[model samples]
Structures are given as structure tokens and as C-alpha cells.
Target: SAVISQKPSRDICQRGTSLTIQCQVDSQVTMMFWYRQQPGQSLTLIATANQGSEATYESGFVIDKFPISRPNLTFSTLTVSNLSPEDSSIYLCSVAGSLSYEQYFGPGTRLTVT
Candidate 1:
């Protein structure tokens, strides 16, 4: 299994601004995913960052809006562009357990847009 870590556990941003969240894993994992959860909702996958290649974003999300970078197996970054009130949520970094098929999540970066 891999242990994931995220930076800037929380932040407050103004509308139209941007914030970047960083994720790090203890060991190389098969997959890494980025997710977001609203105040009272479940996690929504934002994208899959492939090492050395462009990221694959989910529907309703785009590269221009949520740019991601995976420099290597143990590190990745996600930038939230042009923030809005609706963007306020808990952003998480996750890794798929190699053999257990379990998923481990970072504490999360809670953003409050105003």
C-alpha cells in the first residue's frame, strides 16, 4: 500500500483567483486520482494524472480549468483556476492500493471561496 500526502490542507481564496494543491505518495503506485467533495456530498473524481503524460479529466471538467501535473510516481499537483463560490470544497489526493484494491486518501485541501 502507498501513503498519500497533500499540501495546503485548507485555504481561502477570492473569486476568480486560483489555487494549486500538491500531492505526494510514499511509494510508487499503479494509479493516482484527484477528487473533490462538496460540503455535504460524496467525492467526485476530477482527473487521473498519468506520469510523464497529460492528465485525463472527467466530464464537466477540463484541462483549462483544472490543470494537473504528475512529475513522477510519487508527486502530483492540481491547480484550480478562476475560482468561484461553487468551487469551495474538499480536494483530495488518492492512491489505489497495489494488492488490497483499497483506496487511500490524503487528508484533503479544504478551500473556501469568497
Candidate 2:
């Protein structure tokens, strides 16, 4: 199992602001995933960031809006661009287990755009 941590457990930002969320893993991992969970909604994959390569964003997500960076095997970052009230959601950082497909998530950074 891998332990991941994220910054800013929660934040309230004004519209049009951007927030950069950090993710750190206790151990090296083969893959790291970023997800967004809207209020009362399921997790949505934003991108997959693996070491030695560029992050891959999902169909609906573009790199310009949600730039991602993976500096090493145990660290990654996700930045939300052009924030809006609709962007308010719980951003979670996750990594899958070595032998299991199950993923472990960070406590999450809850963002509220006001």
C-alpha cells in the first residue's frame, strides 16, 4: 500500500483564481492518478502522471486547464486554471496498490469558489 498526502485540506477562493494542489507519496510508485469528486458524485479521473513521461489527461480534461507535473516517482502536482464556482470540488490524489487494482486516495483538498 502507498500513503499519499495533499496540501490545503480545504480552501475558499474567489472566482477566476487558480489553485495548485500537491501530492506526495511515502514510497515510490509506478503510477499516480488525479481525480476530482464533485459534491455527492463519484470520482472522475483527471490525469495519470508517471515518472519519466508527460501526464495523460482524460478526454474532457485539457492540459492547459489542468496542467500536471511529475518531478519524481513519489511526487506530483495538479493546478486548476481559471477557477469558477463550477470548479468547486474535492480534488483527490491517488495511487494503486502493487498487487491490487484498488486505489488509495488522499484526504482531498476541498475547494469552494465564491
Candidate 3:
């Protein structure tokens, strides 16, 4: 099993501002993914961060809006740019496991744009 940790368990930000959330993993992983869980909605993959390469973001998430960086196998960061109330959601860090098809999540960085 793998474990992940995220900073700023929760925060309230103003519109047009930005917040960068950090993620750290306990062990090396082949794939590290970022997800967003909005209120009353399901989890959506924001991007995939692999070591030594540019992060691959999912549709609807552009590099300008949600820039991601994976400096090494163990650490990554996600920045929410030009924030809006619509961006208020639970941003999570996840890592793919060896056996399980599911990924493990951090407690999450809950962002509230007011």
C-alpha cells in the first residue's frame, strides 16, 4: 500500500487569487494523479504526473488554469489559477497502487472561493 499527504487541509480564498497545494508520497510510484471533488459531484482526474516529464492534464483543465509540477518521484504540486467560486472543491493527491485498480487519496486540500 502507498500513502500520500497534502498541505493546507482547508482554506478560504478570494476570487481571482491562486493557491498551490503540495503532495508528498511515502514511496515511489509509477503514476501519480491529481483529482478534484466538487460538492455534490464525483471525483475528476485533473492530471497525471510522471517523473521526468511534463504533467498530462485532462480535458477542461488547461496548463494555465491548473499548472502541475512533479519535481521528483515523491513530490508534486498543483496550482489553481485565476480562482473563482466555481473552483471551490476538494483537491486531492492520489497514487496508483500495484495491485488495486483504485488510487489512494490524501485527506485533501479543501478550497473555498468566496
RMSD of each: 1.2, 0.9, 1.0
lDDT of 1: 0.92
Candidate 2, 22-58: lDDT as tens digits:
9999998878999999999999999999888999999
- Model 3 quality (TM-score): 0.95
lDDT agreement of model 2 with the native: 0.92
Evaluated at residue 64, the lDDT of candidate 3 is 97
Query: Which pairs clash in the backbone of model 1?
Result: none
Which of the two candidates, 1 or 3, achieves a greater TM-score against the reference?
3
Q: Output the worst ten-in-a-row residue range by lDDT, candidate 2.
A: 96-105
**Which 10-residue window of candidate 3 scores lowest in summed lDDT?**
98-107
Q: Model 3: how far is 63 from its true place, Å?
A: 0.4
- Across residues 1-114, which tens digit of lDDT does each residue of candidate 3 receive? 777899989999999999999999999887888999999999999999988998998989899999999998889999999999999999999998886587888889999999
TM-score of each: 0.95, 0.96, 0.95
Give me the runs in candidate 3 sitting further than 4 Å from their true place.
Answer: none
